[model samples]
Target chain A: MSGHSYDAEKYWKANLRLIFGSLIVWALVSYGFGIVLRPMLSGIPIGGTDLGFWFAQQGSILTFIALIFHYAWRMNRLDKQFGVDEE
Target chain B: MSQFAINIMFVGGSFLIYILIAVWAKAGSTKDFYVAGGGVHPITNGMAIGADWMSAASFISMAGIIAASGYASSAYLMGWTGGYVLLAMLLAPYLRKFGKFTVPEFIGDRFYSKQARLVAVICLIVASLTYVIGQMAGAGVAFSRFLEVDSTMGLIIAAVVIFIYSVLGGMKGITYTQVAQYCVLILAYTIPAVFISLQLTGNPIPALGLFSTHLDSGMPILDKLNQVITDVGFSEYSADVDSHLNMVLFTLTLMIGTAGLPHVIIRFFTVPKVADARWSAGWALVFIALLYLTAPAVASMARLNLMTTVYPDGTAAEPIRYEDRPQWVKEWEVTGLIKYVDKNEDGRIQMYNDASDEPGTAFQAEAEARGWKGNELDVNRDIIVLANPEIANLPGWVIGLIAAGGLAAALSTAAGLLLAISSAISHDLIKGSINPGITDRGELLAARISMAVAIVVATYLGANPPGFAAQVVALAFGIAAASLFPALMMGIFSKRINNIGAIAGMLSGLVFTLSYIFVYKGWFFIPGTANLADTPANWVLGISPLSIGAIGALVNFAVAFVVANATDEPPVEIQELVESVRYPRGAGQAQDH
Candidate 1:
């Protein structure tokens, strides 16, 4: 029980920070690069289309998979750190 | 062997496997029925989630939608899969820690209000029922095609298959069955794509094949598709969307709605731990991505193949004579999905966009010079995927595999949705409220009965589909986004949201979304009774009704905070519950009364 609250608060803060960062990449790939900023990035071609178009169809899905796995890996580490992991 | 025998062998063989699994894993208790004994491995559960999440729409119709609409349809691909990121990060782990059987049970307990639970149930039922009707209809189509039965008989056949395994094994049965289904559907979806990709781009991997150079044209496959489609007077394959705001909002609605849906969320419950739940969501996306990544390749490749078939000699030159069309066209023609009429008294099939009003008048002028009166070839979008094997001239076994695969996609999702609906009735409504003291045996019986009832209702609706059956997918996602998702999120993340506040938020979201959709689609989607047209000019802020759910969610959050701040905070115990759920500690098998 030593430093339990302190560790929990720290763990949550870290988790939230990780989540916040993940979401930024999430939004950047899907909504930002995929939709809104598409025209600006239209000059950079990929697979016969612009980077934005790739992000919209293919890149966003691939990025989303990475984001989820990354969150899972990081959160599992956080769980161990905070001693909140189920044994 | 004939094609009919091969299809039956595949479909019948798959059905036997499902029934054997269901019999082997029959549910002995409500716990097994509800959460599959709450000991499912994350990867196993993830495969089931893949099967559950990818419905008939994803398997059969989505590629067709992408093939038709091109870049604008990316919203469906990205929006659907992107929600898993939200699910893994925002919802799944905590809900698993909360240790509940049904979604509304969590809502009811977290909010400390029966009203909140009931609202959650309503949202789950409405959204799930609407979604399942489409699946039933889709299964019917697949059945009629392969079984040579009318769609009504096909619907009944689908319902019986769903009832057998879902009622027998419950989640345990469905979980294993869905793993089988995932394999079948993925093979069904990707094999034809692989063959077609190899044919077009010399790449067996469909996702990469999409970007590789077309072997015949010596240009990137997408570039070749764009040129081919534009030559036929269609818009550029990668054209920018007309309304970016609507696209953003539409994608947002699908994401949040995907996160909120009861069927998808419930799959996480079957996992053993909070950490497993998180990993399971990631695994689910991995399986789903296998199909999703190939879908664009399938869509673009199928479209190019279709265009080339029609204009055998370029569109500038003469098209092939109608009588000289390929075997695939004639095969599809018997199904009435493809039709060709001799326009301008020409024997050749002059298939091009003949619309004079569009900006591209160049194709129209060429058509006029070629003495074409109208677009003579009418191809249904649904045929793009269904006829893909034939289009690629694959063997009979592949076509049979596709038959079984389509049914697997439809049946797997239908069972998942039916489970969600039945559990809401048996566990949440019956045991939680109507008969709180009901014995475990009695509740299990009730669960089975409701599962049977739900299947009957689903089949009936699927057989005699409403005119707007196709349009209700947006409604399903809209309600889920507006009502259940916000309420669940607030219940977990906001300790200050009292019962009154949670109830207010749910009602506001439900009413706002429902009214917006009803105003455009008519009350209950009764045709010709809408207050205003569903066109873009009459839209609020140019946001279509499909995109209004994102705004509705904002309304929910805003209303929830205002009401919560004005009123009282949630009780101390509930606040502590939120704290406990936030961590991964002490999650055991889901508790049964």
Candidate 2:
């Protein structure tokens, strides 16, 4: 494999993919379940109240951890694709 | 031991640990002083940074701030952590690749101008100083609260502890000590939270307990809280208060600011490789999570605890007779953080948000029913975390542990900030500019002296302290966000960004952001000097002073880009430097030069 010669476009595209996907989830857990979609999620009770409150307090934070990990994993793969992966 | 003696013993034990760590890991030479010999493990470095980043505000007050204000407060949670992500991605790895001793060194070398380095130095000092003062203040508050002492005495103790370790250890010493501090703090924070969670929700983990059913209420505790709180004319306990636009901007600003914080970013320089820097950030967050996750639970449970204690029958009647209030309530009341007045000459407590004039409103009704004048309880939000365990009637050890944790948070961050400031002074100010021909020994001596000066300043400021923990944290975040972040980003990302552009942008952002806060907050929050009333409603564009840095950052980018496009591109060698910084090629062994 060529050193520092893999596709820049692919790298850019991969970053975009990760960003948008993780952002969508971030928005969903935080905004969707937390506020905007809170009433909609009120039907599915977490313990007693709807899922929205959980999303606000605990869900958003948990999702952030997952999001960062997902990004790290995807970006590592992208790094390998671009031949920028450190030995 | 008396509860006060127990508090002193626990706090004394923590200081002993920090001092021991400092002595064992104290810097041996200039190399050891600057970057911890670049030998730190990713995990250890992460904990060090977590301690370094959490500060007294995060450990003691953040959750209460969030619980009290509702949605507008989510910014602190999302933004502060989000900044770490930005740090990992945009700044840390690249900066580590540059392999510098100080942030100003990066600016000077990248921009190839002493003026640019000077600009970075000024910003670093201002941001670090403002932030360190807050930590000092936090340390003082922590000492005062648990030690049964006045805050001024607490400030002096915090300062002395910081001076001993920070002046002795430098960065190398500070790093190892921070690791210990991180442990002490996390344990201190979690113990009480666990006990409270178990009591309230039958869950051991407070984070999980937040969503669990309340054993007492026969429902999810939050629902019960909302029901009871709103019945007394309070907004639903779980309701959101901030608009989406403000929340997003506020979070973004904090993220950007956190990423930009000179002290936290400098922690990455302690590790060996670019990969270590990346992993170090993840680790730091993990350590931070140990406390962060527990904080909200502590907050929610604490709020619930306070309410229940105040209103056993869920109203003003027989409100825990003033003389019969819990030991914790009596203890905190003396701090002036909690106040009670038998205004009606009644022996009962009537705590309600009676600000609403609408007679039919729940709060007004509760007040009228109870013969209360207004929201009688004036509990300071900062006390929520510190007083939670005691409030719940948990064992003495848990309360003692919290005292240790709050001190750890303040000390670790203070040490980190001081190191950043001192390194900038010794490396950039003296060696780089004041006396380029200074010997290695001289540089080392200068570094030590500078560290001493930084500690003295931090100690002095902390001793006096600006009084508010979260507010001070916001100011720290605002300055860091406004100035350092933009300069660092442009330095690495834009090769064509000339020294002029970098300096101009930094100065512009710094002056704009600081002056904006000052216009409303008065010069240094010295009351009677504020030209405009200081509140969210009076802010320009409805942006809180906390959010001004985000706007300032935009100005920085705009000024930088326009200037860069107009100027000639950076020299070929500079471009090479940029490319090398981008990829970690041949950055295998970070030399101890």
Candidate 3:
């Protein structure tokens, strides 16, 4: 029982860390590069518009999809590592 | 066959397919009814979620909104898709681990109070019902235009079709049909976009075509769009027309609201495992991105086509003669969505900004010199996607496919929302709170009855839709973001929030968001009943009612924290339950227990 409790705690901590990491990138691409820092990226052009327009409309969505898949893959490995994975 | 006949065949054929699928995948037990027996493959679930998430707004109006608003409307794309990231990381996996038939069930058990459960149920119903109204209205419009019926008759036919499938097979049926709907809608959406993009930019991919050089102008499509629209007194397509603060807040509100919508959240529950739930969100976005990425292309291309059609040469060239208008214009005019009053009676159609505002002012002098009267062409934004095939001169089959796609989009979402509402009533209200000992058969019967009632109510509302019915869908997102999201997130993330705190937080958020919307959008959306006009100047701290959900969420979190800290901590068992849900272990067999 004690070992199980310790594993659960460790799993929870690892999960939180992964979430924090992913969310930082999420915020950066969306609110940061997409809106706030867009002017800085205006010099770099993609397709027809500047990089910021790409991020706002197309790039952010692509990043989000990538982030979710990464999180899912990483969490599955972590679940196995912590001996908490479903059979 | 006539285009109308083709449309009927396509729409009617899709309905027939849905009915067939519903019959084959009939939900025999409550588990099957509620969460498709928790056996859905992640990719399949993803496609279903894609169909379920892209409502009438996304299908029928989103591209039009983007075409009209340009850069500012990217908020919808970003907000809608970004929320799934939050859902995957913040809510979905943990909720799946908790393993319940409904969202409110998790609230009830985790908070250790039936009152908290009931409050969550109320929030779910309010949000889902409001969201469903928009779907019903969208379906009605599609039907009225294609089937040559009145909007009311359209609503009834839509309601009856939805009633048969959703009530019969519940989640199980909705899941498979949505997969089919997703295929139809995606194909329907993309074929026209690809054709238009190729014609406009010499690029096959609409997303790339948006940025590629225009075939005719030999300049970038967006740049040319900006030049022409500005010449005609409209804002540049790539420019920021809205205040920066409003844009940021609006995007934030939509992202949070998207994460909080009950119907979308419930999709995760259908997957077999927590891992499946996480991956399914990624896959769902993959499916949705197919449309989201193309939408801008569709919008820009459609705008370019419409502009060139009306102008016939360039923005500086003389406007096209009304008598020489394309067949599509006359076709759309029958729907009353596109009107031409000919205020100048000048024989030629004059399309320009009529607003006595800053942007309109910029174009007013130019328009006046041209001897143009007030803008004669009042093209409803909703008509853009519906009329896109015709606008692009795509084949009649493509037009027929779009009608089917639009109806599929609306029906798929309406079915999803109806299932959510019915489950809340039968499983949450009747079974969970009212009759814990009710048999499975009785509960299933109750589910069908509740679904029938919900459909009737939604159809009736569709017939006499409030002026803000379209906007009410946005308000639904606000409510979901404000009330349900915080509580659900806290239940998994924090073990300390008690029943009293959760209930109080939900009530405050719901009330605050609702009143803010009512004050601006009319009291309960009653026409002429608003206390103040819904303008940026009249907003509280410049937060429009459309974007007030973010503040409501903050209030919910703050109040919940304050109240929880002031009271006794949650029980040890509830704390342990939260700890359990945080891990993905032991989630394999999450039958509704």
- Strongest candidate by lDDT: 1
Each candidate's TM vs. the true structure? Answer: 0.99, 0.92, 0.97
Q: Alpha carbon lDDT of residue B377, candidate 3?
A: 90
Which TM-score value belongs to model 3?
Answer: 0.97
Clashing pairs in 3: none
A1-87: candidate 3 lDDT, tens digit per residue: 123477778778888899999999998998888888888898998766788888988999999999999999999999889878888
Docking category of candidate 1: medium
Q: Candidate 1, residues A1-87: lDDT per residue as tens digits?
A: 222388887887898899999999999999999999999999998878889989999999999999999999999988998788989
How close is chain A of candidate 1 to the true chain A, as a TM-score? 0.93
Best by TM-score: 1
Candidate DockQ values, in order, are 0.68, 0.33, 0.69
Interface RMSDs of all predictions?
2.0, 3.3, 1.8
For each candidate, C-alpha RMSD in Å?
1.2, 2.9, 1.6
Candidate 2 Cα outliers beyond 4 Å, as residue runs: A1-45, A48-53, A71-87, B148-151, B316-318, B357-362, B465-471, B523-526, B589-593
Grade the docking of candidate 2. Answer: acceptable
Q: How many residue pairs clash in each candidate?
A: 0, 2, 0
Which of the two, 2 or 3, has more TM-score? 3
lDDT of 1 at B145: 91
